[model samples]
Target: MGTLSPAAPPTTPERTKSRLLEAVKDCDCATAQALADKLGVTVPAIRRHLQDLQDAGQLEVRTEKPGGRGRPQHVYVLTEAGEATFPKAYATLCVDVLDQVERLFGDGAVLRVMDARRLEFQGVLASRLAGHSDLGRKLTALAAVLCEYGYAARAYQENGQWYLTQRNCPAPAVAKAFPQLCQAELTLYRDLLELPVSREARLSCGAAECRYKVG
Candidate 1:
């Protein structure tokens, strides 16, 4: 069976901040104890972490009761600023990709090449997700790993294929305009993930570089 491992754990406080922010982005509220339990850390450790995060304005805490509860409990939620941190890694990745593209394709041709690369990337992801029984679970796993590498990915089903869309690119303004750049990214995706290794199989980008579907 093919299995994937999750991204490595955060190694620094700043990375921890980003992870915490991403974890709570969709959760309306979470308790310190609940967070500690989820993260597998001691309650005191979670309290200290939350205090530091709150001081940095990455999170806000308030006490509230949900009617059946005996007393109000403090719940932690991400601030607008906290949510902003989740995309910071992506912005960094874009800079690195754009710099390399400029070196290889000239500044003028970089964006075009990169956009095309992005489409090929989508095809690689589609190929990986093709035979999975639980598309959403597989995508969530894939996106989580991608998020760690500086791309905010979201995947959903379209027709019989899974479509993975990138909301933010480190080279956003350029990546949005050039399809070739996206195509180049697809090449990197193929190489990095060990995809399309078969002699008879070929990966190609489609009509829209922003979207890619594999057969």
Candidate 2:
């Protein structure tokens, strides 16, 4: 006799509702029509799902007026509750550990940890960047590693300059508490690239992205 296969997990009342929630997660904010178009569903059906999620505290709605529009559009954003449904790696935990280390030891101890992390990051980058003779190729490999660690990173060339930009910061909490993290990363890139990698902006500094360029 053949053995029984494992059963599939139970789903919510409407699978489309889950998709709608994910849509908001992806865009960070979306309108009913946009979600409908993305999921290939009717507007009315999408509204129902958005309403249900809002009622259940899974989303928040905001009103936005288009530059040229007859009616203000309703935008949906995932609430803390909705965000909880997705997979996450809490960088706050890293902040907590750093706090404990600072408490037990001192600021000097935390700085040392930052230095150690700089070495570790350098090692990882060096391994992947091996044999990448072109500067663009090296930055592309570095971008891949950063994305794997949750920083949404991209490498590109513009105006005859090569740049690495990170749109998302994986460890905001840690970076906020320990400015050393930023400094250490800066030092690491300089050492590894053997060139001056100037930082044009920083996400932690409220800029749109953390940008580094070879000049």
- Model number with the top TM-score: 2
Model 2 residue 96 distance off true place after TM-score fit, in angstroms:
2.6
- RMSD list, candidates in order: 18.5, 18.7
Q: What local lDDT does model 1 show for residue 24?
A: 62
Q: Rate the local accuracy (lDDT) of all candidates.
A: 0.61, 0.86
Q: After superposition on all CA atoms, how large is the RMSD of candidate 1?
A: 18.5
What is the C-alpha lDDT profile of model 1 across 1-215, one tens digit per residue?
Answer: 97999998757766655555665675555887777666667788778888998898888988888564778889888888777775457645765676776788787767565556566666766666556656466656666656666766666676776555554454555444444555566565455444441112112222222333322
- How good is model 1 by TM-score? 0.36
Give the 10-residue window scoring lowest on summed lDDT in candidate 2.
9-18
The number of residue pairs in model 2 that clash at the backbone is 0
| Stretches > 4 Å off in candidate 2 | 1-89
lDDT of 1 at 58: 80
- Runs in model 1 lying further than 4 Å from the true structure: 1-11, 26-28, 67-69, 88-215
- TM-score, cand. 2 vs. native: 0.58
